[model samples]
Target: MIEKTISGQDALPNISDAERIFAELLTGLAAAQPGFPLAQLKTFVDQEFAQIKHVLHGISLLGQCPDSINAALICRGEKMSIAIMAGVLEARGHNVTVIDPVEKLLAVGHYLESTVDIAESTRRIAASRIPADHMVLMAGFTAGNEKGELVVLGRNGSDYSAAVLAACLRADCCEIWTDVDGVYTCDPRQVPDARLLKSMSYQEAMELSYFGAKVLHPRTITPIAQFQIPCLIKNTGNPQAPGTLIGASRDEDELPVKGISNLNNMAMFSVSGPGMKGMVGMAARVFAAMSRARISVVLITQSSSEYSISFCVPQSDCVRAERAMQEEFYLELKKAYWSRWR
Candidate 1:
């Protein structure tokens, strides 16, 4: 039996719609009288189930590609998230293995108990099972930590997980299926005429990801870059579309700027004073304090005179970061070496 438990306090409402409806039925029956037409309720539930099943079957029938491709499918949610995809591939006589990422990591003795040797573990697993013609589907992001505790890879983590798997398996390419066609010149919602990019280098992709592009996580490109693997971002609803290819720089000349990315709700902090001029290690000291406080600096700009430095961080972290700076530079402030401004 699969044992699933809610974690966070606000996670109790994460049940499926079917489960919620069944609960309503139980509550209604409990409040009703002895002759409350139990048979009618059962018939209604059966009809609803049949209708839902038919709708799901219809959706599953939409994509029926005859050609089979070997891949490591790392999905967003639980197994049900990729049920239709699995069905379509299986129908085409493709052998697929639905792997539990956490369990697979444990099986290879990589994570959860000791140091994570991702490369070694993946090499062993890839060499052992799943024939050349078969595809492997896995739940992404969720894994075991060094102490055997559950860990998630944070935002856009599924994309990162997919890249990791592809690098380890030495796959020809990795693809990310999303709602949009591919990475756009700007967010379509913000810029109505935002154009799609056909291709970009891995360095550009990483920079865009860090600067607020949501297509892939910043860490997703690290392993893939090490192996010089190429990644494609495609839309699940538009499988035939040629999506953006992220890899090494092509020999052909291209535009200087491929896209624009932005993040909002940020506060800027500046450090400036006459004493800061020509001071060695002053910038390092300022940043080290933020690092110790676990504050992420979004952007940094230093004056050419070297007397002032300015940086931006999320508004949520500004207050904590300020306090950390005060504590770290108390001596400097007392000596009138620098002043902090927000």
Candidate 2:
């Protein structure tokens, strides 16, 4: 909706879609408890809405959504959702404590797309703001950046947040509740015969997620794995199902390949020529260029003859990768000693 408004495709609605949905949530909660403090809950909603509107108005005036403003908007949305959940739990007579990741729980490295700065975040977590007894409700994706400004972990960050929290709190296990029953040999929607995996090693889960398993976020395993914390992937809709558990144990008698996964929208780049054969530091130089451009290489392969090296990156990074390689291998290309292909 914010994107649509910025593009002049829609009127900025009277309230954000989130606010409207949260208002309906408030109404439902009130309906369940006639004596609930509806006014108080509405006030919380109003405050959150005001902040969102303020950010939206800024976007309108600027005619662009800057990274900082976008991050702020994400933080506000997560905050509102957590607040509503807290209100609902409170209405049911539960002692709920809302913990804002931006304020306390997480510390991230970048403005919009970010990685958790585990050292700093773990330091903050050690300070221990989480209440021992209250039912804690946390903003899933928002975190504080190095500037103490609001930022977010990249897509599927909530699962990363859960793993970080579980690791920091020294929990025995981390459970990721999602729509599917558990991780499968392949995405069940695409492969009807995809088998549900009951358990997997941490390395196996990491590989599966990195290769495009949608059930677990790619980075979610890092923290938990580092702490030796087992992670359970379960279906929220079918809690009784024996979900997939990711841990240290490995089954030697199991199939060599436990799962099959694939990444889509990838572009492969190849550098080949007689110049590359037996060329010392040639592959290193090629990858250093990608690192400088901040392009993540997904996979790499080299020929036995050592005449060529090829790597894959997301399709979106194709242009940048091409430019980086061109600049890095300018002399080789100019002299006709090396060739490039995509």
Predictions in order: lDDT: 0.66, 0.80
What ranges in model 2 sit over 4 Å off? 11-16, 33-37, 106-108, 129-131, 251-254
Candidates in order, TM-scores: namely 0.70, 0.90
Over 130-186, each residue of candidate 2 has an lDDT whose tens digit, in order, gives 667877667777778767788888788889888887876788889999998998989
Put down candidate 1 lDDT per residue, 78-156, tens digits, no spaces: 3333443454456567788776565554322222112224665586566567777778876666554444444455556
lDDT of 1 at 117: 46
Candidate 2 global TM-score? 0.90
Ten consecutive residues with minimal summed lDDT in candidate 2?
Answer: 9-18
Where does candidate 1 stray beyond 4 Å?
Answer: 1-94, 103-117, 251-253
- Model 1, position 254, has a per-residue lDDT of 66
The root-mean-square deviation over C-alpha atoms between each candidate and the true structure, in angstroms, is: 12.6, 2.4
TM-score of candidate 1 relative to the true fold: 0.70
